[model samples]
Target: MRDLEAGLVDAATGHAIVATDADGVVVVFSRGAEILLGYPCDEVLGSHVARLFDEAELGSVLAAGDLDTDAPARREWTLRGRDGVPVPAEVVVTRRPGVGGVPAGHLFVATDLTERRQAEQLQDELIGKLGHDLRSPLTSVLGYAQLLDDDTLTDEQRGYVNAIERNGRRLLHLINELQTGTGRSRSAWRGRRIRRR
Candidate 1:
């Protein structure tokens, strides 16, 4: 059983898995946790898990109060590292049972969100650029189509001009939708960042 547990811990690449007694004392600190937070198991195993985060940051986790054994809770927060660096992380906590099937400890699995946030920012930037490039030509096309209505033209020419105006408006609408979607995504990102502060 010990060997199986050890293997599980070893396999937790890029994921921080920690176990703490019901009293909040750390008992299992996996290698992935060390890599993520820069603390070795020997140093953290006997310490309280709260020591890894700021006093204020615990609000999201503690708000749930005492959890029933087997019940899992999740939250996102900025975790402070041994080096005093803050890492944006999402943690899932599950209550573990002891010999008598009573709640004895808690297990935590945390994933770092730094890379994911960076990727989102990059995607937003790219989308913004694409929207800008598309709108410029669309604006010109719409303007020209609108001006054509003021000129004298044959019936067939009027029909062609109307088609141009209609398609131009449609293209402009599509671009606006793209920009609106990107703006909403950026707003959500900002909201999450503000909550973490």
Candidate 2:
């Protein structure tokens, strides 16, 4: 069983795995942990597992409750790299059961969240740019529609102009909602004019 666990840990390349004794002393540091944390196994093996975690975060977790529970605990944490940079990670800590169901040790597995966070930030920026691009043209359309509501037109012409104005205002309101993440009334835009640039 120990050999099987070691084999699995060695094969894992994408997640950092650190196994510690019940007293929190590091015992097994996987290759993935070395790459993720910038620390070789020899330097980390005899140290306390807390050295790999951000101090404040570790303090908070310790204050919250014991980590040797039967159920695995998962949370987002900031790990301290050997170079002293903070590495965002999703961590899962599972207790290793011993004789009579007591905890012998704990296994800490962490997955890096840096790339996922960067991708999300890029997505938000693109959405904001798209909203700005859409709004500029929409403002012009609404302004032109408002200008066409003059008194020199037949009933049919007036009806067509009114339809254009109404639909344009609705579309603009929808765009504003998308950008701001809140519903706003079209009356908020009443009497607003676009300046030529």
Candidate 3:
């Protein structure tokens, strides 16, 4: 008797994994896939993945191609979970290439964005609140500096006001850019050339 290594990889590292054949039949379904999609590997392994994504056009851009050129189409699409709940998830398809650089099959690697999306929404709210909070102090500082810069004030006071204005401008720039999307690698985002840190 031959022993086949069965039943999932590390759940921590292996959350939601699905495999498909040339005909797009789910061949290897892991425990992680079950937890994420609510479908057992045994029940889903032979089924078409499109059934989960077809209603929402999840397989529209999908085709058998090399990973470098095709494979992962990083886009926001709705996926149908086992309970018929529509999940907003990001689908990443990794393609396998065989010998002679030909396309073989596809391996899908999915990271659930449900929680991440919620976090992003919360972050947006915090940023807005922080920006508004900072604006109040900034406005006060600007007003005080402007009053000092008036002809009624001395030369040294005018210089200090100018410095304050410059620092205020710098703070505004800091809030807008570096703190934003620079935190994540733009693997799915297009156009902008990434500068390596």
Candidate 4:
């Protein structure tokens, strides 16, 4: 049974697992924890788990009585690494039961959020760039359409110009919303009617 538990913890390379005794003394530090925290098991074992957290963060958790419950508690935490770097993570902590159903220790499983945050930021940048690139040419098209609305044109030609300007304004409005991350409804645009000059 011990061997199976060890194997499971060792195999989880994507999630850091740290087990502590009821008093918060480090008992098990998985390989994933070592890689994420830059701490060797030799140095971390028998040490207080509080050392891995910022003082204020640890204090908040303790004050919140998160450890007093049997149900797993999850929260976002910024753990201090061996090199003093901060690692943002989503952490789930559960109480480990011992003999006679008494709480023997706690198990912490943490998933690193650094890569996810970076990817989201990059996506926002790309979207902003695409919106800017599209708006420039669209502005030119709208300007030419406006200039074409002169009295020299036939009635049908003027109607075509009106359609172009209306659709162009709608498209521009959508692009502006996208750039601002407002995510306004598309149905709102459908009901709007742009007046012709």
Per residue, candidate 4 scores C-alpha lDDT tens digits across 73-136 of 9999999999999999999999999899989999999999999879878867876898889899
Residue 28 Cα positional deviation in candidate 1, in Å, after optimal superposition: 0.7
Pick the winner on lDDT between candidates 2 and 3: 2
CA deviation > 4 Å runs, candidate 4: 150-159, 184-197
CA-lDDT, candidates in order:
0.80, 0.85, 0.65, 0.89
**What does the lDDT come to for candidate 4?**
0.89
RMSD of each: 7.5, 7.3, 6.8, 5.5
Alpha-carbon shift of residue 197 in model 1 (angstroms): 47
Between candidates 1 and 2, name the one with more favorable lDDT.
2
> Which candidate wins on lDDT?
4
The 10-residue segment of model 3 with minimum total lDDT is: 1-10
Query: Residue 162, candidate 3: how far off, in angstroms?
Result: 1.8
Clashes of each: 0, 0, 2, 0
Question: Per-candidate TM vs. native?
Answer: 0.79, 0.78, 0.68, 0.78
Q: In terms of TM-score, which candidate is stronger, 3 or 4? A: 4
Tens digits of per-residue lDDT for model 1, 46-68: 89989877678686447757345
Worst 10 residues of 4 by lDDT: 185-194
Off by over 4 Å in 3: 1-13, 54-57, 63-78, 86-92, 95-104, 173-197
